[model samples]
Target: MNGAKVDVRKVAGEGVTWTLLATLYLRAWESRLPEPILGDRYAAGAVERIDYDFAALRRRIRPASNQFLVALRARQLDDWSRAFLARHPNAVVLQLGCGMDSRMLRLDPLGKLRWFDVDVPHVIELRRRIYPERGRYTMVGASVTDDGWLEAIPADRPVLVVAEGVLPYLTADEVRTLLARLTGHFTAGGELVFDASAPWVARVAEDFRWAPRDAREIERWIPGLTCADATPFTTHHRRIPVRRYRALYRLIHAVPALRNAYREFRFTF
Candidate 1:
């Protein structure tokens, strides 16, 4: 697997929004939006990608499961973000592995909280064209692994770390290192929120097939992070026979039983 070549910058635009995973989630959210939020171009950008290649993405990602999980995780992440902002209005909030997400606008904090979006150089470069970095919201074009930008985050206030649909891309050891860095640096009550893919997804992503190339890589070398609270995000799709589960089953080329093996987990460290 060419895990080494999976450019972090590719994570910025269509690689994120153009996939079945993101397109399906946006369609559902757009359908539910009240007119006031429509003017927000972040959401519009994602929806545009979907409208552009609705057919190709749908064919590759095979929507049903990806859409359900992404939307569910979005709710979890937004809720945690807004709650933290309410308490530590001046807190530093980091969105790790933030793709073309509308999080800054969705969880618009009312105070001096510094919201930083951290991703690879290419992704941040693309984002620069769309969202301007203001006093409150900022963009960092550094890979999460490198420590150079850790200083960019305020060491004073507690940081609420958020990773949605991101952890799976990294190898287990890298994930552990990232978590240890976060917890060791922050005080208690400063939490990390992120999701985990089932071993099934890891199996499919063995070569970055549909997900991150490193999914399988991390499982072996790195031990899982042990946190104050690590719980699986428990919510299932409407009950349907295994044969009928569309999205989960679409990756049959790799794992034939992948359809019956759908599972989602969310954890903190």
Candidate 2:
């Protein structure tokens, strides 16, 4: 499937691409627009091509970050990360496999920072159509596994990597390879921030969590990289008791039986 390009126009552009939360975030963006909204909204009045009850989906997709519990987490992480980038004006920040996240708009960095939004070519292609890069924000169209893209990025500068809802879909080996490659290339004091699905919790996420990927084997993939427990609020989202929020989500979705539903981890390179 590598290098296979699906003409953005020709894909089965009916429902969502199954990137779940990211797609929902995009939808929220569109909901703010004064339309002729020509982005992902389909002819069927559906944003995602998936055949689900959109009404039901809308109610269930209320992100915790939108709530007090998750809102604190979001501000904490985003503020801290933005501050870090501010200090490392020349540092390279990579949002690997970024789907349709509006982090660029949120961070809204000026020309001093060098930021990249990296993902599969098609996603970048799609994002470009909606949100064009202005100055410092550039979209690097490549997967995290492909080192070829790294060549275009300056290795001399420190790298700050941010990944949200990405690794669980990868096999552990793929996760490690990506981590090793990133850490190996980063300058000292560089950091990578991301969250993980506790093994058991991650399994349940395959269906409920919405994004698809190759990250199921995250533990086995890379032999190194420290897991600095970052459960408390480090970014925009604060850490809720994993069990508490998972239960809330379960009860919110009426799936309370799901165990170990929320897990998180972070580390430096």
Candidate 3:
């Protein structure tokens, strides 16, 4: 896992594992840019710690489109979370299935909020080795779908749930159960930001990529959702600071597939 090249495919048995690698790759790529959309030094460090040829891995993952999209999606998520923190500085921020991402550091909540990075035991163990624990930040080693782990987080304050690239891995039922429990537990109400694919897109994604077997109908999953809206990845492209692709990105939005394939959502419960 150090300097020696290791097969990323074998190293990561789950989709989240590959997603984490892709994230690190995007962050590393951004770091080299003159004006990066996300200045994530931690992501660059994480990539170096993993023993693999990142360039070769990019080819394997189809870097031409995937890398740019990954970076764009991440920036969108970060923007929404930052806004939430601004409004509710004392809120509890729960990052479900947090996989080696240094979002907490990137946002720097500044001890105003209780930040919890929740993931499975194995990933948590790996994160413990890579990232240092900071004040007002706790890492919970448990599956996001498990309800018991939520107990560790205090429910007194408003909550902000950031579930980027997580809902797609969960089945429709699992998504339903998780959302219901979360809304129930946080009766005081909170905001949720997550990514979801359309049913048709989900079917195609499963055949060619890593997507849940059962597509999640997010709106139906949470009937009590206060404000649910689909935000296309391209919608946030113009907001990106990178000038290299600004013109090209604006032009591509005309293609429906490029605009709506993977949509993010912001909800209130």
How do the predictions measure up, each by TM-score?
0.66, 0.65, 0.84
Sort by lDDT, best first: what order?
A: 3, 1, 2
Candidate 3, residue 111: the lDDT equals 55
- The list of candidate 1 runs beyond 4 A from truth reads 1-42, 49-54, 109-112, 187-189, 206-269
lDDT of 3: 0.73
Weakest ten-residue segment in model 1 by summed lDDT: 1-10
Per-residue alpha-carbon lDDT of candidate 3 for residues 102-185, written as tens digits (9 for 90 to 100): 888888735545899988887776677667688888999898888699877888888999987777778767777888888878
- Residue 116, candidate 3: C-alpha displacement in angstroms: 0.6
> What is the TM-score of candidate 1?
0.66
RMSD of each: 8.6, 8.8, 4.0
lDDT of 1 by residue, 105-200 (tens): 767734256788887776666566555677788888887878878776776776788877666667666676776666656554365666665565
Q: Each candidate: what lDDT?
A: 0.55, 0.54, 0.73
The pairs that clash in candidate 1 are 171-218, 172-218, 173-222, 233-266
